[model samples]
Target: MVLADLGRKLTTALRSLGNSPVINEDVLKKCLMDVQRALLEADVNIKLVKQLTDGVKKQIDLDNIGTGLNKRRVIQTAVYKELCRICDPGVKPWKPTKGRSSVIMFVGLQGSGKTTSCIKLAYHYQKKGWKTAVVCADTFRAGAYDQVKQNCTKARIPFYGSLTEPDPAAIAYDGVEIFKKEKFDIIIVDTSGRHKQEDSLFEEMLQVNNAVEPDNIIFVMDASIGQACESQAKAFKDQVDVGSVIITKLDSHAKGGGALSAIAATQSPIVFIGTGEHIDELEPFETTKFIRKLLNMGDIEGLIDKVNQLKLEDNEDLKKNLQKGRFTLRDMYEQFQNILKMGPFNQIMGMIPGFNDFMNKGHEQESTKRLRKLMCIMDSMSEEELDSPEGHKLFKNNDDGSRRLRRVARGSGSSPKEVFELIDQYQKFAQMVKKMGGMGLFKNGDLSKNMNMQQMNQINGHMAKMMDPRVLQQMGGMDGLKKMMQQFNQSDGSGRPGRGGMGGLGALGGLNFK
Candidate 1:
């Protein structure tokens, strides 16, 4: 089962407790049973699953229950805590020092995505202003050097690898030396993973480890290889001092549970997780956020981080226009561009609370295509039409807006109705922004920090009118929007990650919702 499915099952189990008015032993017992069943189906190691359930039960002391204690809340928290313990090794991950060269070596069995992860890490660091380089020392596997070289080249990361190098350790040593001379802050070495855990492979890995003396040794495991991950992780940890773990192909992998099992076996923290083949798909493993997203609670923190990384200058321009209450079709189009940069829509929706279950297969792709079509429609407009709040004005002032709409539709290879729809969408967004601008939300630069509940409710009421009737209803209407805002406020007020002064998003700085 996927982690999202496991989360849903566990959440259903927990909700059963809430449904029970009497917090009796039977309810708790059934809940634990459901949790155990879900974990087992996920391919979690049975022993670890038992240990987690046992821990949760031990945390609950019904006989010693105190006043004002909510038994349901206690049990839920205990279950969440136990699941985290199962995945967490409780060891500190190695941190690269600023201004000092740090070498990270990747090791794993063949086909474990070791080389791809090396490039991902290098690219990740490079984006953060670190001078990063990659070294390919996988002499055992033919084309290993070629793969690493090509991936690094695509990312523009400096790389060093010798095709004629017979000894991978020698190549690793030389690569490190070259990068250090170049003052690269982060150097990643990708070693051979072609052989099984035999004497020669282990010997070579050990030799390379000794040669580079890397700051961290990351053990990459294919998450689809269930149960075997534990032994593989143990074998690597026993020989080469594996410091951290990175599980790849977690999505669509029934063995994600087994990947968790490896963490306990190696006692190494998972520093990152590879979700997809894209270089940007490597996600930093945060325990709370992982558990939260697993349970479909949404990773608002991650969503905010993604937006912050965009640094969208066009978004900043939209923000300025919004503050002046001069939002236009041009500004709406910029917002669409920013959304595209944030990655797939459902991926974004998955990070929002209460939206996971609503997303359907092909829905994101369809939405993306529609967005492109809208952009194409905008491209066909004149500069005055593009900047005007009412794009229909261009046609309405002369003939029917239909004439201009038809011309745009033909140019953009769409129907007049579709062109009109884009204009309608722009109008709704502009109206909402104008309303927000009048509320003085951005005047103090706090973005409605001073607004009371009544004001928020009034604003949402109007915005809700501009939304699709079905979507507005699916979001629990105005009350649901208010509850969502309350969740944000509570989390931010408590200084949660990506919360506090950041507000709804600096990226959403002058957006109507902000």
Candidate 2:
């Protein structure tokens, strides 16, 4: 079973239990059986599956349960924890320290996304203010150097590779020395991806590992390989000190169960998982959060981290406008830019509870394209038009409303109708902000602080009316909607208070850009 399918099966089983009028031992047994089947089908090692199920069963002693307790919730929590246990090897992966050079060597079978993972990790640290660099020591493969060079150049990260060098160990040695001399914080050495039959290549991997003397050895596993991931991870672990794992192609893999097996095989925790082919698609792995997302429970902390990464405090001008309940065209455009920065729309939505189903319905691409078009329309606007507090009304004051709309359409390379639609969306957004201001939600810098439960409920209800019917339905109606908003208000990006700003609202609420 694919991860999505597994989640659905488990969720269905649990939901059925929730719907049952009388909770009995049979219901719990049936739920566990379904979970066990799902995990086994997902390619999780049978032993681990049994252990996880057994753990859940032991935790839920129906006879000892209090009448006040929700039996269904208790069982669900046990299953969640047990699932997390199977994924977590209980070993911490090596982490690079800032202001210090930490060499990380990559090793894996061919086509495991080793090369891409290296660039992604380097870029990940680079975004966090680390001076990162990549060293391509995969001389065994043709075009490996070219691939690294091209990707590194595009990412603007310094890289070292030699097409002429036949010795990968020498290349690794030189690259590490150069980066160390440059005082780079994170030095990643990408080695040749070797197969079990390729003994020479495995020897070369060891040589490069010795040459770089890496602080961490990352074993890249292909999630699509099913049980093969365990053998491959064990092979690499035998050859080198595999300190961490990076599972690639997780976004599309039907057999990501192999990923769980690989963890148990190597006894090393996964550091990240490659969700997509894009360079920025690698996500840091946390067992609990990963299991939560797998079960469609959402990853709220991950969502907050992404929002915090935007550093919205720098946008004082936009903050002031939002607080005053005034949203200009430029504000909307800037929010779009932030959305793009926050990574893929699907990835962001996956962090929200109940969005998995919406994403599965395949609206990610449609929403993304719509957002870009809205940005382009705004991009065509003049400074006066974008900054005007009159928003959509600013166009009406023109000598001819159609003339200004036509000009914007021509500039944006879109139809006048599309431009008009953009303005209409902008009006809806401005109205929401104005309504929020009227309710005193935006009176304080932190919107989370001012709103009581009643006010929050009112705002959620209002936002629900503006939301697409399909999305609202997937969110489990108003309660799901309120939970999503409370998630945003409970913490800013850092899990601290004062998230009542435009960052939280625009990220989820204002995104109702039809």
TM-score of each: 0.91, 0.96
User: Which residue window of length 10 is worst by lDDT in model 2?
Assistant: 441-450
Query: Where does candidate 2 stray beyond 4 Å?
Result: 396-399, 493-497
Per-structure clash totals for the candidates: 0, 3
| Tens digit of per-residue lDDT, candidate 2, span 73-100 | 9999999999888888888778878768
In candidate 2, residue 299 scores what lDDT? 77
Local distance difference test scores for all models: 0.76, 0.83
lDDT of 1 by residue, 467-493 (tens): 566555656777766666555544532
Name the top TM-score candidate.
2
Error (Å) of candidate 1 at residue 82 is 0.9
Candidate 2 TM-score versus the reference: 0.96
